[model samples]
Target: MQDLIAHAPVLFPLLLALGASAGFLAGLLGIGGGIVLVPGLYFLFKTLGYAEASLMHLAVGTSLAIIIPTGISSARAHYRKGAVRMDIVKMVGPGILLGVAAGTVIADHLSGAALTIVFAGALLLFAAMMQIPPKVRDEGHAMTPVKGSAGGFVIGGLSSLMGIGGATLNVPFMTLNGVPIHQAVGSSSALGPVIALPGTIGFILIGLGVPGLPPFSLGYINLLAVCVIAPLSVVAAPYGAALAHSVSVKTLRRVFSAFIIIVAVKMIWEASHG
Candidate 1:
């Protein structure tokens, strides 16, 4: 607690900045912002001299916690626009729940270093994914219970491990499988909570009683970071969505791709050298 207070001069501003940037980027790119939040908080906490063993855990857990409110709002907005596919959400929901439960258990067993590698790998994957231009296609295969469950499991499990809301994976999966892009994006948004809710709880439960956690943390979820980032990100997302109408998403995506690759490499380098 004292350490956080002492560094408040430097850390608060950075947290605020991260929150705003995560929100803005989310709106602009149609992402969930876990890509921004996880790395951003990890480095920020690292600078504050928290325990190395828990830094990534803290980052991931708190990032999941922050997604809850923002994701709900996003889902609601999309639902109102008739963009959401509630049927898809149901088809995948059960598997996503099961997958998240397993993912949490897996995360709890891994060391922080391992978790960091996993997260960086996700960043690299998503960065590469974004670099590719969208391909036009006719209606694809039909969604089945088996396919939905399997895809949902993958999305939920990976998302839990990485503290993401799963849009990066979900949208692509949906689109590739013949869902329209708009409906896919909307369904992805709706599933954000499906991924986040249990994931957050899992982190919290697994983190309880762990030593060297930052102050104001509830298990792995840092309450301080969540409190600071959630509102700002929520407030900033609308503006970002608004800006999306005017900006060139292609250019923005290319720049973002470059940025994430850099973040991923830096993380890998730091892990190797640390």
Candidate 2:
């Protein structure tokens, strides 16, 4: 704790910068910023010399912690614009809650390297899907609000394990199921908090009394990171949401997909080398 406190000046600023960028992306992409936050936290923790065994867990937990406020902020912005689909939220909420519980248990058992590999692989898959044309992607039956239970469970579970807000999966699912792309993005913003809150709590509970956590940590969640990141992310999220409403995002999606792929490859390399 002393060491972290002593380095607060340096770390806090970095976290704030990371939060700013994450918030913008979350709002813009409806991604809840977890995809960025997890990798950023991992790098920060690694620099601080946290044990490799627990580094990924801490990163994921902390990412989810920060996502709570950011998600709410982004969601509210979208809701104000009448972009969120409440019917979809209602249909998926219960299953997501259950899946989050299951995912936490799964995360608790996995090694950090294993978790990183899984996260990386999932990112790659999502990125690939993002590259597909919408017409080709939506060849199956049209999406109905009530038909999302199974997908919600799977997304929620995988999101919990990856310490994400479930946007990566949720957005694609919605879009492929006949939801308008913009509406899908908005709805995904709302889902972020749903996945994150339970996921954050689960990580905390799962890591309780576990060893090798860094300073200011509550179980696997890093309080310091959350404190530094959440406020900034919340403040910036609205701006991103505004941008999402104002801008054409087709180009942005492709760019973001490329970025995700790069991040995934980097994670895979790190996992393989480590």
Candidate 3:
């Protein structure tokens, strides 16, 4: 806690930069910024002298908290562009809630190292999938309840563990099912907050009474980090949404794949070395 305050002069700027990038990516990718925020916050918190045992947990929780506002902002921006698919969101909502419930409990029991490993692996798998074009490229059938809800349940569980909104999985699923990439990204943006809202609260409740937490923490959600990051993310998300609408679908996929690969490799290396 003392270390955090003393270094605020330097740390604040870094956090602001993180928030800016995160917000932009949230809009661009509909990932709720969790994929970026988890690793970034973990690095920042580690440097601030937080215990290793709790570093990833804290980061994940805080990332989820920041996603709530950013997701809303990005979703609204995408909605205005007529890219968001409310139909899909409605189909998947219930499964997301159920998945979050189970995933939170699982996360609470896993060690930080385990969580990092899971996060890294998920990033790698998703990135690889994005680079590979679907073989058929045919329009998929309408999303049935069985498939939509079931798939959403799985995405929700995985996302909860990774401190993400369901976008990493949602975008891929929607695109494979014949939805255009732009609409997939936009729809994912709307779905992100649904995962984040309950997921944040779940993390908070699970983290309570745990020792060695940083100051101003609500469970695993760090209020201090959220206060700085969420607002900036909210403000920047609209711009990202605009950019998403401007670029070619191929370009967007390329950017997302490359970025995730880089981040995943870095995180994996650090986790292995540590």
> Tens-digit lDDT track for model 1 on 64-154?
9999998998999999999998888888888899999988999999989888999999899999899775442455575677889998998
Cα lDDT of model 2 by residue, 1-274, tens digit: 6887877787888898898988888778656578888888988888877789898899999998888887787789889999999887877777788889999999999999999999889888877776765441453656654568888889889999888888778877887777777788788888889999999999999989988788889999999889888898878877887999888777888999998899899888998899
Is 1 or 3 the stronger prediction by TM-score? 1
Q: Which segments of candidate 2 are over 4 A away from where they belong? A: 28-30, 133-146, 238-256
Clashing pairs for predicted structure model 3, backbone only: none
Span of ten consecutive residues with least summed lDDT in model 3: 133-142
TM-score rank, highest first? 1, 2, 3
Segments of candidate 1 deviating more than 4 angstroms: 134-140
Which candidate's TM-score is highest? 1
lDDT of every predicted structure (CA atoms):
0.89, 0.84, 0.83
Between the candidate structures 1 and 2, which one is better when assessed by TM-score? 1
State the weakest 10-residue window (summed lDDT) of model 1. 133-142
TM per candidate comes to: 0.97, 0.88, 0.87
Model 3: residues with Cα > 4 Å off, grouped in runs:
27-32, 133-140, 240-262
- Count of residue pairs whose backbone atoms collide, per candidate: 0, 0, 0
